[model samples]
Target: MIWEIVLFVSILYLINIVLLTIIVFKGPTIGDQVLAIDGITYGSIVLLILFSVYFKEPILTVVAIPLALWVYALDIYVSKYLERGDLGA
Candidate 1:
């Protein structure tokens, strides 16, 4: 059933989150930390979609879109800042 699939995906996502949290703590460089954070953001979006399906709420799917875009843009901004050493330059 769809519910079973959603539950499996949710569990996998949680495991990934835990692993990524460890990576964030052990990341060797600033860029590594940023990348790990991005990964977590993406995982959260997937988890949100799973919840949306489980709860039969169509609006949460729409919510995930903006969150995904925001996280991606934030990743770009951070990478740019890291590369340029200045946010406004």
Candidate 2:
């Protein structure tokens, strides 16, 4: 039962990755590409958490928090750069 759930979630994550890759490469605009990259980062975070559960290693789960924070920072930095053409305000 639990194994089935894990398999299902893993499949979904793979599908998400494929779709995001398509969007990242063929998006109509830079904003669309950036959004797709952000989506990929979030999907990676979810995968990390899922892997931690499947492996029964609580310590592995700790990595996802910092990864999430880093992705958030990246989104902010990119948005700022796009809006102002500079990273520094």
Candidate 3:
């Protein structure tokens, strides 16, 4: 049933979270940690949408999109900072 699918996806997401958590804490370098945080952000976004679908909550869907975008913007800013010395011209 639909619950089975949701359960499966939730388990996978949980595993992803665990791995990302380890990388975020013990990653060898800053770039690796940043990428791991990005992955965690994206995974949480997907998990949010999935739960919204399961619960039939439109508000959660609405919330997830903006959070995802914000995470994306932060990721870009961080990557730029990592690549270049400054965020300004």
Candidate 4:
């Protein structure tokens, strides 16, 4: 049962990767591309968590939280720079 769930999630993640790749390349503007990249990053983090569960190791799961937070922070920082032309200075 658990193995089936893992297989299902892995398949879904692969589909998401293909879809996001198309979106990233087909995006019309820089902002759209950035958004697509961010989406990919989010997907990667989710995939990592899924992998950690599949492998039954707590160590690999440690990366998931930091990866998610870092990507979100980067998104905010980049948006700020784009809007104001400077992050802080």
State each candidate's clash count: 0, 0, 0, 0
Question: What lDDT is obtained when candidate 2 is compared to the true structure?
Answer: 0.86
User: lDDT of all the models against the reference?
Assistant: 0.88, 0.86, 0.85, 0.84
Q: What is the C-alpha lDDT profile of model 4 across 54-78, one tens digit per residue? A: 8888689889888778878988888
Judged by whole-model lDDT over C-alpha atoms, candidate 1 comes out at 0.88
Q: List the residue pairs that clash in candidate 1.
A: none
Candidate 4 lDDT for residue 58? 65
lDDT of 2 by residue, 30-61 (tens): 88987888888788788878888888888998
| Most lDDT-accurate candidate | 1
After superposition, the stretches of candidate 4 with alpha carbons farther than 4 Å from their true spots are: none
Give candidate 2's TM-score: 0.88
Q: Is candidate 2 or candidate 3 better by lDDT?
A: 2
> TM per model?
0.87, 0.88, 0.86, 0.86
Cα RMSD for candidates in order: 1.4, 1.3, 1.4, 1.5
lDDT of 3: 0.85
Ranking by TM-score: 2, 1, 3, 4
How far residue 34's Cα lies from its native spot in candidate 3, in Å, is 1.2
Clashes of 2: 0
